[model samples]
Target: MSQSIIAKRYADALFQLGKERSKLDQFETELLTLREVYRDNNKIVSFLKHPRVSVDQKKKVMTDSFQSFSEEIVNTLKLLVERHREDIIADMIQHYIGMMNDAKGIADADVYSVRELSEAEKQRLSETFAPKVGKQSLNLTNIVDSSILGGIRLRVGNRIFDGSVSGKLRRIERELVSTNKR
Candidate 1:
């Protein structure tokens, strides 16, 4: 199945469970931890993705490997592995977090820059995002795009803030054309 459909189901189910249990915040942190676990362990990911391995074996490993987490996470993950939807596990967790964020009125921002910014620069950017967006805080994703030449561009949902040098140049050219036409 496509990532969208998978994400929707996984996200919705997790969201509902979190709400019911009042462990939504815990689930958020644990989900991040799980995503990291999957990302860092290529062997584990490959093992899960391999068609030859039965889902039974997968569940047993999960129960053994991550014995530290809550029973809720453990059981939920078991269900995922059992259903053979482990491939989209990371995305599903993320989509669920996103949905929860939206329900809480949180804004997600995508920041694009020609070069990676330092930690201080990131903090400053968040401070700037607040007044500009009229939001108390933002959930920002940093993206590096060297092709931008220089500067930063940000997108929050439907709104886009273009400050990249290449973007500015394009806008300037468009303005010049419109002015000449006028």
Candidate 2:
């Protein structure tokens, strides 16, 4: 199976477990932390994936590194090591987070602007766009991209609402060119 499909399966199972246990937030947090740890430490991931390293040793390392995490989280890490699927940890965590966000009617958005958006601006954008996207609110991550020139571009999932000056100029140019050609 594709790695993403496998990861989604694991994420679904974990999500179901989280829901049943009423620990959705806790599980997502733990998994995100684990994902960050592996992401930031290439050596640890390489060590775990080494052919010579035993599963027990890898599990021990995981236990030591994540000792404070809940048993369910630790066991899931050990399970991934045992199955030689440790590489999917990050994907699984992402899918789990998506699931959590969907459950809460929240959408994660990337908003690109020429300058940093103030809290009030962000809140206004969230309120204005969230309803359009059928989401309760947007968890906005602001990115300053000077290329936008002015205005902002908002991306929620695969949809983009490009209100940037550069984007408008491009659209107008396209329209004018098409009309002239006709």
Candidate 3:
């Protein structure tokens, strides 16, 4: 099976468990913490994938490091270790977080502007664009991009709403060139 399929299965199972136990948000937080740790530490990956390491040793390491996480998460980590699928932990967390966000009618968005956006600007953008995208709200990640020149560019999924000054200028230039050619 593809790694993504395997990751999705695990994510779906965890999502169901979280939903049934009324701990979806808590599980999301735990998964995020684990994902962040794994991303920041290459040594952990090497340790998990080491040929000389016993499964018990791997499980013990995970348990020791993530003792603060819920039993469900810890158990999942142990299972991954046993199955030698620890590499997919980050993918599983991303899928689980996506499921949680979908359940809550939220979409993750990337907003690029020349400068950091204030809370009010974020709120305004969320309010204006969320309904258009059929989401209740947007979880925006602000990116400072000087290339936009002015205004903002919003991306949700595969769609982009480019209202930046550079974008407008490009559109006008395209129109002018096409008209002249005709």
Q: Which pairs of residues collide in candidate 3? A: none
Q: Model 2 lDDT vs. the true structure?
A: 0.93
lDDT tens digits by residue: candidate 3, 70-178: 9999999999999999888888999998998898899999999999999999999999999999999999999999999999999999999999999999999999999
For model 1, the stretches where C-alpha displacement exceeds 4 angstroms are 1-3, 114-120, 131-134, 142-151
**After superposition, candidate 2 runs with Cα above 4 Å error:** none
- Candidate 3: global Cα-lDDT? 0.95
List TM-scores for all candidates, in order: 0.81, 0.94, 0.95
Model 2: lowest-lDDT 10 consecutive positions: 30-39
User: What is the TM-score (0 to 1) of candidate 3?
Assistant: 0.95
Number of the top-ranking candidate, with lDDT as the measure: 3
Which wins on lDDT, candidate 1 or candidate 2?
A: 2
> RMSD for each model, in Å, please?
2.7, 1.3, 1.2
lDDT of each: 0.84, 0.93, 0.95
Give the clash count for each candidate: 0, 0, 0
